[model samples]
Target: MNSNKKIIITAIDQRSTVAIVFQTITIGLIMIGSAVGNIGILLAIYKTKSLQNKTSIFVANLAVADLLAGLLIMPFMFICSIIGDWPFEDASCNLTGTFALILGAAGMNTLGAIAYERYCAIVHSMVYHLKITNRLILIVITFIWLEGLVLSLCPILGWSEYIYYTNEYLCTVNWAHDVSFTYTIMVVMYFLPLGVMIFCYASIFKVARRHLRQLAMLDTLSPPSSHNQIVSDSDTQPRIENSARSLRLKRDIKAASMLFIVIGTFVLCWTLHGCTMMCLALGDTCPVDFPEYVYTMTTWIAMFNSVCNVWIYGMMNRQFRDAFRSLCCIACLRSSNTQVIQI
Candidate 1:
């Protein structure tokens, strides 16, 4: 064979192998993590009637968006990666691609809303009316979805251009490599929400610390056991203290801790991918050998954040942990019953 033919064969062989491996790893991780997390959250809410409060409702909304993103986007991406181009017909392409983009955008926005809500619950508890009506939450959720739809559908409507990186065949907002577009999106999607999250969570932590300090102070001030004390007042104070402590722990876990982890993971994964795209657009001459693979991997990493959120919840929130344990027990019972029948 000629040298040209030999090099051509070698390149195709290499690219094909890399594509297969990347697709498999991305698909496996996203699918298993998302499915398990979604099931756990759903079962947790259903079994624990108490978990259906305002906070869990917001979480449920976020989970629904992430669940859809995982189920729709990752499979579509996996097929595209393996086929080396758009696999769907033009109509299917438009629908699937648009749906994926919309849900992905909505997921981010929902996370921002959750962050803001947590901020309010922690920092401004006196003003927080748990009377957040169903109508209000529904309106908020609908607005979030609509905002995402508008942004994602702009290219389809000709307000923007949809371009795929030739190397990876993944589509995104090309914006003609303009920093303006990238910066605008970064602000809208990342910077603004991240700022809100950081500020709110910091406030939450401060509030918790202050509350704890006050409790410790009161404990110290209370008279010794020998002192005459109103029995009911004494009993009530301990109950109040215990309840306050429980709340501080819960808020600290959900708002001040777990939420930061989610934001951190998201910023880490998407920021790199976004910066690389910006660099390539600005004529940085990205290395061709593995740029696409790196980009694809990082993109999946961002998506994986969605998958990990439920586990974060399970780890941080007592209610989520209890719900997850219950789910596992139920699964174990079903498996044992199946074996008994087979016997």
Candidate 2:
């Protein structure tokens, strides 16, 4: 080749190499961080009694699902990015792609369950305890997992099938083929769960607003005690009125706050991808083609929803933080002991 042509080819090769390396490192780090964060939260929940509850169990299920995605799915995606092709054979692609889809579906379903749990606790406070038992929660979780598993397995069983996208550098459900099946799956798995989440959170927020308004009214009625006035039982009526529901209300409020953050983040991360998927499903051809980096970035952002949950829930709860600290201390002690023995 001439010097000028050779220089152009070298620059192109260099750019491609740099892009692959950057994508590989970025996804690898994301996987590591998500794995570590989710594992820490799991251990924290196991070790801390106070962190164990119906809602926490559901949240932990989400973490477990997301952790598996980070461990199984994201690595394969990064590998595809590096290789610039789908290196795996048909069976491997199907298995990994099915799993990735299953976990994602499960995570969203679990979030909907959490929203419903919060709604029940806040809106129908009277019957919430009776309605939301540990046994019942476990049953619901089992149903969520089973639903995702069944839907995910449909493709593997040859209902829809899996395809490795060369351009995007990922393996996912073959939604581009069989528009009818794609729309059906979208409605059953994605749209239904999304609708449930919206409804539950909306109801919870409405109840929260009403509760806050009531609290305000109560506060307004209870005037500050004057220095000259003698202390009276009437002065403490507001406290008496609040005492019954205060703890439960406060707990629900925190639960709502934490879960809201999670849902908001999840939606933010996945909205673009979801929209793109829907748009493609409706069109005659999957016309939307993003550049490699843009597609990869969007997918990773959605994957991040899984990793971010443990941090969101942990940060909001003191018990979880303490448990995480204890776990850290134990890890440190083990490292120190190993060093001493080596010495």
Candidate 3:
């Protein structure tokens, strides 16, 4: 084994056996949780007839991308953790690293799509129905995956390669001290998406507030003689408007809020990883041992985005939540019927 790999084994071996057990349990939990969440979203979307709307279609695509992340990346990470150094040969290492990076980028871009869609639905409600065609939504989804594919291929196409520091027991893209690359990635991957999401969400909040004010105005305004019937008519419109507006606002708020929180978590988790790479590129000696541990934890935190996105879908959207519940209930019913018949 390499010297650096020896150090990692020594360090991790120094920990109490209990610590290893706890770490194992945590990894297992994350794997299982991610599996259930992803599978639930896919099944629910496919089975629920009413959920065939444009918004749900996009959400289902997001769920599928996230599912790939959880299934493809998480297991590779777990294997790396159990064994110090890359267990696989060079080709496998490159493939694993590329898959993780691509799926992760795709998942992030999908969140951008969700944010933009919500922006139109809430901020430009009148025109949203007219302008947001099924074809347009398909184009957006296509663009997101394509962008991710191109980015993930950059490193493989002689731009960069996997660097296994052995000391880190992780595989990540090579970090060059090139300021231009650093700035470009930070802008493209982090800053641009973050900025767009924030802007759209801010607009969503403003529109929702205006919608509420409109409802209040309708409630306060009254009519003249023969006013009773007019008042009823006025009341009917506002009530319907308020109910629809409120549902939309609530859904948008939850979805946007969830994305913000998850993306923020991604930023926090990956910041140290990015910083360490930048420092390495600049030829600065890093506090490697500690930062490696921190980066590993952050990678898990970023992985949390995949697992959490499904829960967000279930929580924020009523149809998704209901469909998931119904699916579970039906599964149980089938199992029970099988048992009774067997008896």
Candidate 4:
């Protein structure tokens, strides 16, 4: 009996050690990936003049929020996961929670803004340039940040409480303590923006498909001219203009599709985490008891969305891809110059 007890204790100890190591490695990877990817996005937008458009502005704002999450929140999470508890004082925990909330809200709102921008560009092409000015976009982004700050501060102002959960091993709003706050955030920050994105993207695609069908009909109806036929400059000019418009429309649709992918990924990454938190807030009324690790895992999955956006941009946007390549080349040259100077 003594030998059996000793063996069980040793096995449990080994399992705990393994879990710690795994958590540390996973968190560390997420931190590094998010930091590096978001930084690359910022640099790509800054260095490439072609990418400095209204949509890019919203993308840059999102990158900034994600960057902060990577640089601040993830490292703290890594430490806490490794130690198996929140090591910081109460004040520090509150700050971390507020920062996380701000970033989360800001990022989601930025995505909604991007979707709206695309919607106008495609559906209201005639007035898009006149209405969606840089000044207006800047004002919208300012409001997004302000709203995030105000909502995030509610907990500190006594509306709710930020506390560390032992199971999750990180500091955040105590959902079970204030179910109202949890529900509010879920409905306002997550679902509202999610609904906006869905509507905007859906409308944008509907317009795109209609335009494509029209273009196809035009192509089919137009008569093919013989090689010997003489074409007037006025006749040729209208065709050229129509062709240009068609190309621009296609490009806009493609860009919207890429952004839709980013929004879809966000929904997939966060929905599970949001549902789990809501369930926890429901307390005894909830049918299922989620494992402690489920919370931690879902949280990590949601945070990983920050890192995924950078890759998606690189792969989908030609301007971003070119900008990333240029940046990499510059960095390599600088590194070589440094080595030469040392030699």
TM-score of each: 0.82, 0.88, 0.83, 0.91
- Judge candidate 1 at residue 303 and give its lDDT: 73
Question: What TM-score does prediction 3 earn?
Answer: 0.83
Residue-level lDDT of model 2, residues 1-343, one tens digit each, is 1211111001222237777888788778888988998998888889888888877888799889989988888888788668766666667777887887789888888888887887887788789999999889989999988888898888767777677655445677766557777877767666777787778777777776777777777767876678998868887777678654565557667767776786688778788677666554554555665444455567778777776776787767888888988999999999999999999
Q: Indicate whether candidate 1 or candidate 4 has the larger TM-score.
A: 4
RMSD of each: 5.4, 6.0, 4.0, 5.7
The pairs that clash in candidate 2 are none
lDDT of 4 at 171: 72
True lDDT of residue 118, candidate 4: 83
Ten-residue segment with the worst summed lDDT in candidate 3?
Answer: 1-10
Clashes of 3: 1
lDDT of 3 by residue, 1-343 (tens): 2321223213433434674565556665777788889889888878998887777777788788777766776676666566644666666666766776667667766777777877887677789977788889888888877877787677677666555544344555655524565566666666677777788877876776776676567556632336445456755776777677678767666756765675565566556556655555654454553544554555566666667777777766788889988998999999999999999
For model 4, state the Cα shift of residue 119 in Å: 1.0
Q: What lDDT is obtained when candidate 1 is compared to the true structure? A: 0.67
lDDT of 2 at 178: 71
Arranged by TM-score with the best first, the candidates are 4, 2, 3, 1
Instruction: Please identify which of the two predictions, 2 or 3, would achieve the higher TM-score against the true structure.
Output: 2
lDDT of 4: 0.81
TM-score, structure 1 vs. true: 0.82
